[model samples]
Every structure is written in structure tokens, then in C-alpha cells.
Target: MKQTTMNRTQRTVCTVLAAAALAAGLSACAPLIVGGAVVGGVMAVDRRTAGTQIEDEGIELRAANRIRETFGDRVHVNVTSYNRQALLTGEVPNAQERQAVEQLVSQVENVRSVVNDLTITTFSSTLSQRSNDTFITGKVRASLVDAQDISANSFKVVTERNVVYLMGRVSQREANRATEIARGVSGVSKVVRVFEIVSEEELRRIAPQPAPVTTDDTKPSGG
Candidate 1:
């Protein structure tokens, strides 16, 4: 019994440590671009194809640049694109600016649709508030990782003003499980699921295939 208890304790400690390490790495909440591919460790598990991933990144970059050039410091907006679906978050000064922001993002090339979650506030979120949002996002991500039943990398988490937006190409079961996990996180006030629900068979169909092994018998002879 003592040995069993000790093993249980050790497992708990390892789980905690692993979750912490993953959270620290993901706390940045920004995807890295390497050789035009999304390289945040999610590429392999992400349901989106390589081409779709690149298009999503392009959509995000182009939309953000357009917003900055048009609105300057007058608006504070965050653009997160996944599977060509762009989600707009943060604060805008007024109704007109809010509508304009959505319109501008819609015009970006290759954007399939836009989900505008911008708040019409007089001032943008303070740095401290944004930091808190990032922390909440990390916590939610860690919780998802700890769940163990779902692939955490399949979801893209974005938080603004305590609201968490989850985006991914997932089945309904995965989406529901992810949403529940996100909502359980302490700092998350709301969980918004922006998922493209696909069938389980469809998910398997789109899954990446392994390269065929080359055997000595199959080796090509030099001419």
C-alpha cells in the first residue's frame, strides 16, 4: 500500500511539472512562422493542412497590417485566423470603428469568414489587463493539456477581456470537451467555441499519412 501511494504521488508530481512546462512555452499566445509554416508545435496535430495553415497566417498578417495602417492607434484589435476563419477581438472606440474593423478584415484576401467579437469601449485594454488575459489563456491551455482525453494542440486559444475563444477543426465531441475544460479554468470568465465541426471519420480521413518506409530490397540500382 505504501508503494502504491508513493507511485501515485510521483505520477501527480510528473503531471504537474509537464503541464507547467507546456504552459510556460505556450504562454506567449503567438504562433511562430518558420519557413512559411506554422511552427508552434501544433503543425503536426493541427487538423488544418499545410496550405490552409499558411493561408491562415497570411490572413492574420494582412488583416493586422491593414487595420494598423487605417486605424493607427485609434483602435486596438487582435486578429486570430484559423482555417481561413478570422476572429477579431479587443476594443474599438465606437460603433462605426467596430463595423469598419470588421469590414476591413473581411476584405483581406483568402479570408472565408470573420467573427467580430470587438467591444465598443472608449479606451483600449490596459497592458495589465492584457497580461492577465494572456495568463488566463495559458491556464486554460494547461487545463486542456491535462485533460489527456483530447489533443490540446488541435485548438487555438485566444483571450480578450477574460473571454476565451477556441478555434480549431474538431469533431463535436472534441469541441465540447475542450469547451468544458476551458470553462473550468479559474480566470476564464467565458468560453467561446469557434470550431469547424467535422465527423470523426472525416477527421481520420484528413489526418496526415506517414511516409512509406524504404527497404533495402526496394532500393533503386544506379545505372
Candidate 2:
């Protein structure tokens, strides 16, 4: 999938929702029908890591007052992560508000990097941030699909703002390799490692069944 100027992530999600409504109008097998997608074809998940959860809590804690004051108790920003990278996604009213969110988040400890995916709700760049985020996730999935050493199916990509969080059961080396690809993508601001290192024994248990095909996919396309 290609990234559009309007936040493709949000658009894609909305597209799925719209397609779902349309599919319901046309189909009798509602349960078997997936909106805008097929389950067996390819799956992209927002697989969050333990570190990402911690980072999210920390960010929320840090910005609780500002966000509440800005939105008047309606928490609009969506926070998610994988491998310690924190992603902030949602609409903010203005550029000042967006910057405020980023400034506050940068103060959090243990954060390797921040990808500011917050879009100003102005007409011009309203969807730019969102499309960038979706592109980041797609690129990461694509990398995993193309990498020979990585198990693309085991990892998940989560975006908060423009940051990419990777969650997977990978060895340290594999995780490092995945992070490298994520960091190398265009438009990626920073890559945060939020993975739980898997030992050889765990790998054997987690990947007992073999896959018929292979993909060189890695972590998030852009962080």
C-alpha cells in the first residue's frame, strides 16, 4: 500500500470501516467477510512490547495536565509502542498544541527516540502526519517481508505520532537487525527498541511450526 498525503494510517483505518459498512450491505456471510482485507492474505498487527507500555504510561503521566487542559478531559491522543519506541497518534487543534505534546514527551526517561506523528488539524497538513505514520508501519512490514533472517510474522508495528515501536520475540541480534532497517527508512525520526529478548529455547517453543514461505520483513518502516 502506498502512503497518501492525508494520513494514510487514519485513512486506511477509516477505509476499512467504510468498506465494512459497504460489505455488510452486500454480503450475507458477515462473519466470513473482513472489511477491506482477507485474513489469510497478509496480516499487519499493532504488536506492542513491554517497553512500549512503560513508555506510554510515562508519556501519559507526563502530559496528563497539558492534554487535559488542551482537550478539556477528552483524551484524543492515542499512544502505543513496541520495543521501547513510543508513537503518538491523533488530531490536535493547532501546531502549538502539537509542539507542546512533543516537548512534554521528549522529557520522558529511557526513550531512545521520538517520532512526532501529530498532525495539526489545519486544512493544509491535516493528514500529512497520519500518512507518514501509516507509511512507517507499511515500510516496516515490507522490510520484515523481505528480510531472510527475520520472522516477519512474529513482530508487530505500533505508531504513536510518527514513532515506530517494534514488538517481537527475537534474539538480540535479530532485534538489532530489525531496528536497523526501521531506522534506515525515509521519514523515520528515531527508532526505539522495545522488544523482549528471546533465548534459543524460547525460539524453539515459539516457532515450532515451520512456515511455507519466507519474507525479509523487519521492524517498522520509519520510526
Best-matching candidate per TM-score: 1
Write model 1 residue lDDT over 46-108, tens digit each, in one string.
678778878988999999999999999999999999999999999998999999999999999
Q: Which pairs of residues clash in candidate 1, taking residues 3 or more apart in a chain or in different chains?
A: none
Q: Cα deviation in Å at residue 117, candidate 1?
A: 0.5
Cα RMSDs, all models? 5.6, 14.1
The segments of candidate 2 whose C-alpha lies over 4 angstroms from its true place after superposition are 1-74, 79-125, 210-223
lDDT per residue as tens, model 2, 53-153: 45655765555545666566333565444444556666677877777777665666655555567656644333666677776777666666556676565
Among these predictions, the greatest lDDT belongs to 1
- Model 1: runs farther than 4 Å from truth? 1-44, 210-223
